[model samples]
Target: MMESAFTRPVARPLVVFDGDCAFCTASIDRIRDRIRPDVDFAPWQRLDLTALGLTEEQVENAVQWIGSDGGRASGARAGAMLLRRAARPWRLLGTVMLIPPFSWLAAVVYCLIAHNRHRLPGGTLACAFPGPNRV
Candidate 1:
């Protein structure tokens, strides 16, 4: 039987991402170690995607954030959401990232980074897999 989202106890919001991608894992680790944001980070591999209203295809694409209240954000917005849960400077940046020009730039930057993540530091061949970008 699959566990539903309601059955899960979330002390904070959740950040879901592709586990198969080394870059993704490394990035999450950095966030955990450095940012220490008040959010739970999980690889899509270990969780029942359906329970989170997510799919392999969806998570395979870009980062996702699900709030304790079930609010969601994807891609750069997801990054913003995560930052908002973090400490001062980062939180402030996240807020600014949500504004018009900044949000637009973030989206573009995220797309470029996503497309070339395999070549980025900490990335691997696994990060190069072709997939749709839902964010």
Candidate 2:
């Protein structure tokens, strides 16, 4: 039987992201202004990865969601959680996204974007894979 590891309880959901990536920072900025959730944003560089039960590889690959209940989700799931935090139609979209086939598709789309994020708006070669290790 497999045992779980993440157990730290958060008072609110926290988002762990790659701070070194311009694209990531810009995306977060847009989300913050638009969604304005009570969620906490912590760049992996400034956070304690061990305390969060995270690794360099995980943060490097995708954004992560750490819920108040200690539930953890990554990539598209993480994005979905943030969308749910948004207002109205975006929240509704988030709800629909988490369902079955849509969830599967969301994951695929997330991976594609994440992998090529360096090529996205505001991104640079600095956002490339095996990106800056400031932590």
Provide the overall lDDT of each model, using Cα atoms, as 2-decimal numbers: 0.86, 0.83
Which residue pairs come into collision in candidate 2?
A: none
TM-score of each: 0.89, 0.86
Residues 1-135 of candidate 2: C-alpha lDDT, one tens digit per residue? 111333445767888889999999999998889888668787788777887789988988889998887888999999889788778888988888899899999999988888898999999887878847655
Q: After superposition, which runs of candidate 1 have C-alpha atoms over 4 Å from their true positions?
A: 1-6, 131-135
Cα-based lDDT at residue 55, candidate 1: 79
For model 2, state the Cα shift of residue 23 in Å. Answer: 0.2
lDDT of 1 at 59: 84
Question: Residue-wise lDDT of candidate 1 within 27-66, one digit each (tens)?
Answer: 9999999999998888877887887788777787789998
- At residue 12, what lDDT does model 1 achieve? 85
Candidate 2, position 83, lDDT: 84
Candidate 1: the clashing residue pairs are: none
